[model samples]
Target: MASIPTILTTIFLFFLRSTISQQIHSNPDCTGRWIHIRRLPSRFNLDLLTNCSQYPLFDDFCPYLPNHGLGQKTHAKSHSWFRTDPMMLELIFHRRMLEYPCLTPDPNSANAVYLPYYTGIDALRYLYGPDVNSSAEHGLELFDFVKEQDSPNIWARHKGHDHFLVMARPAWDFSQPLINDPPIWGTSFLELPEFYNLTVLTFEARAWPWQEQAVPYPTSFHPPNLSFLESWIHRVARSRRSTLMLFAGGGGVSATPNIRRSIRDECENDTKNGTNGGYVKLCDVVDCSNGICEHDPIRYMRPMMEASFCLQPPGDTPTRRSTFDSILAGCIPVFFEDLSAKTQYTWHLPEEEYGEFSVFIPKEEVVFKGLKILDVLMGIPRDRVMKMRERVLELMPRVIYRRHGSSVDFRSNKKDAFDIAIEGTLQRIKSRLQEVAVL
Candidate 1:
């Protein structure tokens, strides 16, 4: 008979093949042989950390490899360090996780691990220690999970870590034992404090709380300081209206009265014949063909194929849905936010084309700044606006991320804010590990 680990490993490999094999049916781009099997799933899928990659051993089988801690967990028992061999990164990067079979619901795996994935912050904590070094530098068990709990066979570690459960779907329940326990906070809006520790960063600040029951209880619900694609996202050139763009559909309320009024007023006042009226448009709550959520790409792609600028507003304050929607729709986003996007993501929107590709609304001046529809109409000069739209067309191919298996650069570059957040968080973990003598 095989040992428990070996048995588990075998079971994992079986599902891994099934998962990869199923991909040929969905993604047209995944025909070639994959270099390394990425074991993780995307956020739209079930895994906590999507888009990130794992190589060879972890990718080939381990579904529970927390983004940050799996390596450490493996090391704790095997006394073996993860090999940072160049060949490994190349393989992992080539066989994208998005193309795997287990990603879709057509044929779900029955024996797959039932555990949900960890957030990026928890991932950092599980992989790196939660301490800071004098030089702000420290080494972590590279490729370790950030917040891995002890297995059933051993004692659970760090009872203090909390999870912020952001309910993007109403089908989920917060009253349960596993979800209600820890530092989990809950936020219906990306800015609201719903989950315990993690932040649900989004771009739609005004359209939130579709139903009263889903709203956060106890009026003092604090706004969450969640993550974003990067900083500098707020500073970009605006996209043109002639080209088509699309936005995702969700349960959030429609544009508030003030926003609607503002758009109407802009249409009445602007006679210059511009795309101000063209920048944003709303779609039906349910797609005509399917009953899935409005975010489904297959259902939402039509509108995106029609317009150029997708008005990205937050479903909650500070967090906007348009960031992902516009990107996925293959159109440039005209961002409207109370806070600076650059504070969260690093490479999200580029700068050289700042005035020519995207739009940013300052947080402090939002109410005073007026609705994005009107601001977009009156704010941009026709000549400049047209030029920006042209730039968007040029950058569309590089900026848009199609449904595929390869890991995408969520942001623009190495110095991007999201990258900084991840790297900085990793350094903090290293320090904590040293102080606790865990390193």
Candidate 2:
């Protein structure tokens, strides 16, 4: 016969052990189990590789994946140019999930379900092709496909709140237009009531919604392993920056008017005048419309690596891919609008003051108010500039997406953008489930 205190102590130990086991199983670093939805047609994804030449910008997009989608080898020291379309993230995610250790074969055991719909590619195909009506009808096809999958009721279990979506473009591209306004762009898939509870990952997110999360825009540089990343960091640390600021993009649209021309004119004017007691170097300006700007990785990264600040004005949208490229090159980004970085990318960037890693001068100050872009950047103290560059270097790893199926040893404590996204998505799903249970 056991004493009362002894039995109570034994029972407590058993419960503690079970709780610890559950915690370990749910930890993303440990288990990280997720299942991909298998209902989507393989033709939509696999066929793209075979017929890539038929699509737009095939020359710029196809060469990055020379290994039949396994990704190019990175063992060689020679620099590889990898320029891919931003929307190609959907396919990369699908390929990476197939080999991810966290992926579970069984749906019942999965923490969340991933719908690998080629939404961006599919929409673009119809938009650019001869079929105009098909582009608008694309959302209907996806919605009908989901509604038909009620056999085991996996999606119906929690009304798809446990499901997740990954979009390479900004959230505005998928938004539906109001009754009075004309349709701008993108499909109506996101506007469907079925997706209200779903978690969406996009390059840029709207301010109102809690479901839409902002992720880093994909850059041309996708280092295979920790050594490649370390090598690049070491090189950048030793390299001398001879330019004070650089702007490598073109003009903006009517809706999002930018001061790119003003900045360009200032750079040219300063170079002609030889200002600043030679303390500030000449500004490097590249006309993006001349040839392939970002398609050639070397041409894009060279000026960025040699400049102290990279001027990032708004493009067609609020966010620009160059912002990530600048960070990866250890160049502090100078933003003209709050929406460009401050409101967007909250998930990837730090919550501290924006000035810690970037510089912000309102567009009005530079355009309407006629403040000089160079003067503003040169005003920042040299010590503060060094600190900002260090901060940007610290955030470099999180802003990049690793090569698909790259050989990365898990024990090395190296995690790229994909790993951070998975961990964050799993955490968000777990929290949502707990809230539903309490309600």
Find the candidate with the highest lDDT and give its number: 2
Off by over 4 Å in 1: 1-11, 14-257, 264-300, 328-330, 338-340, 350-356, 362-383, 386-439
lDDT of 2 by residue, 259-324 (tens): 876786677677533355243466887667644675566776888888889999986687898899
Model 2: ten consecutive residues of lowest lDDT:
67-76
lDDT by candidate, in order shown: 0.31, 0.69
Error of 1 at 298 (Å): 5.7
Residue 177, candidate 2: Cα error in Å is 2.8
Off by over 4 Å in 2: 1-39, 48-51, 55-80, 150-152, 178-184, 252-257, 271-280, 409-411
Highest TM-score: which candidate?
A: 2
TM-score of 2: 0.83
